[model samples]
Target: MPTQPSLTLAQDLCARLCHDLVGPLGTMAGALDLLDDDAEAAALAREAAASLRARLQVWRAACGAGTGPMTAPEMAALLEGVLGGGRVTADVTALPPGETFAPDVAQLLLVAALLGGEALPRGGVVRLAPAEGGVAVLPAGRVLAWPAALADALAGQEVEGPRQVLAPVLVRLAQAAGWAVSLSAEALTLRPM
Candidate 1:
């Protein structure tokens, strides 16, 4: 069986989720507030709600029990959800329809995208490509902030100290997928054994 994160790490994940959700949640609330006065606001509220729903679906696919053999369109929607109306963009245009990945693999790619977003504080483009055995993530932007410790963990190295809050979970997911994670200044790749 794949390794599961410890309780403390699980709590950290929850905190991260809450952090990411705050903006969209606030958007939904603000949209509703506007609805009381303007008809156009209702449409905006609906859009925000839909965005939230899409993001929730992606979160479920990543962390929930029902990891899907999700279709290309489905995966595209999930990636877009991660964009979250930010300056960052995902180029999933190359993904062919009907192609799917194991849930673990999909989750790792998503998390990698999240990592890329974090690396580019000012926002950038995330490019996706289906490679043999797994996927490739290319982020073009400012300097990447990936810590050396996390890189070692992802490369399947044993580290001594307490793991970074998000490290254990991501490493577990990548390992569960039978993937060897490699990160460079230009891109991150997950290669299956």
Candidate 2:
């Protein structure tokens, strides 16, 4: 990749993260503002702080410095924070006992779950299962429409557009780790190359 393209990719990824974070952050800001009139200011402030902390935990794991190990269940909890309720159910039965993922793979898995959940805006179950040589995300429910260009981007092909932004980052990370990325209506699989 050229220097300019890499820079552009980084910028776009930043934008996507900001877009996702803005909601919780904005809510927290509003809660703080409510302190001026609300009688339950302390409770409201505590609730807002908890929400902020949950979001920060997810974002931290998603964009962490890749220095620590993370488990599948931990990732699921962070993902639950992102989904904000019982909207997405996580299943990690296939993860080996005591197995942990490197920071990058853990982040990629969490992001994959997020994408899978987004594919089912009406709510669904996201399963993390053992694949042939790696892991797979199986989302079952109302499968939303996914653009072909975005699929191409997730498969490591260069593409441009707002929807394609984060998929490419996942693809690049998979590539660097010698993993194959696959996308389909039912599931997304990442496996050894």
Candidate 3:
């Protein structure tokens, strides 16, 4: 049987989720307070709500139970929804048309995209493509930074805090899916074990 996440890891993940949600949730709250006074605030609230929904969907796919296989187009849509807006975008053109990924693989891909987004702090494109019997997540931007803590976590080092939690989570997902994680300045690739 697979090992369950430790209590600390679970708590850190919860913290990370709360951190990600707070900004948009706060925006929505503030906008709603001014909704009757300003028409623009209603639009702001809608945008914030959309961002929150997109984030929740991506998180569900990454951390929740598998929902079965997903086609490339479906995956692309989800990636676009989650990674779109702000400075980052998702490009799925390289994914083969009509191709499908098993639920575990799909989850891994979603987590990989999240990591790719992290690598691009100044806004960039996260490209997903077929790799050697697996998938490759490529992050391109003017300034690419692979966080040191994230790198350590992915290397199976002790996770320091909530900010680096996703790295270990990604490692676990790759392990469960029988994929080997490889990281480089250019891309993070998951190959068959």
Candidate 4:
């Protein structure tokens, strides 16, 4: 039987979702798979669920989803949420006491910061510093691998398949928000003014 367009789209979405969720979920799954039996797996699964839950809750808070206002404490939780293991550590020496970006800004900034974090594989410091208007992404160290197509997206180009993921989206985001960007071979900093 010929596949319906809706089925095709659904299949495509499923593939994308699996591909995206696979990494973290797989890590959790792998941690469980190493266990002896269902009982062990169940326990490990609970831990994994806790991790995912914490990450999701902080992400939701950072993105300002269903939240009327985001505060400094909430942002701190989000910071700690994204940092797992000794991979990264955030030092919020001074966070704005009672200020938060709009929902769209909050979500986009969170997404951009998360994307920046992914660029550092061996894992270094990624700072969300206060810039002129928006913020600056300070990802230190080498092994930085931002998707190349990101530049094109910044120049207002549509990206093709198997690409257009994080960095590109960040470029597009910076553009949309009137955020000015300064990029080196190793870093990308943006400020909206």
In terms of TM-score, the best-performing candidate is 3
Error of 2 at 182 (Å): 1.2
Q: Which candidate ranks first by lDDT, i.e. highest?
A: 3
Question: Candidate 4's residue-wise lDDT over 46-113, tens digit each?
Answer: 76677666566644553224354455455545766465233654543344667776555555566566
Q: Report the C-alpha displacement of residue 70, candidate 3, in angstroms.
A: 1.5
Task: Using TM-score, rank the candidates from best to worst.
Answer: 3, 2, 1, 4
**Whose lDDT is higher: candidate 1's or candidate 4's?**
1
TM-score of each: 0.77, 0.83, 0.92, 0.66
Q: Candidate 2 vs candidate 3: which has greater lDDT?
A: 3
**Tens-place lDDT digits, model 3, residues 87-189:** 7888878988788888998888888888888888888999888888778999999978876766786767877468887788888888899989888888899
Q: List candidate 2 stretches off by more than 4 Å.
A: 1-3, 40-45, 84-86, 147-149, 161-163
- What is the C-alpha local distance difference test score of each model? 0.68, 0.70, 0.82, 0.57
Worst 10 residues of 4 by lDDT: 59-68
Q: Between the candidate structures 2 and 4, which one is better when assessed by TM-score?
A: 2
Residue 104 of model 3 has an lDDT of 93
lDDT of 2 by residue, 1-193 (tens): 4657777777776776677667657766777788788868657767666766765676566655543678877776666645524476777877874788987788778767766766666777888999878898887776664446558786557765555565766777777667887887777898878
**lDDT score, candidate 2:** 0.70
lDDT of 1 at 82: 65
What is the number of backbone collisions in each predicted candidate, taken in the order shown?
Answer: 0, 0, 0, 0
Q: Against the correct fold, how does model 4 do in TM-score? A: 0.66
Question: Which regions in candidate 3 have their CA more than 4 angstroms from the true location?
Answer: 1-5
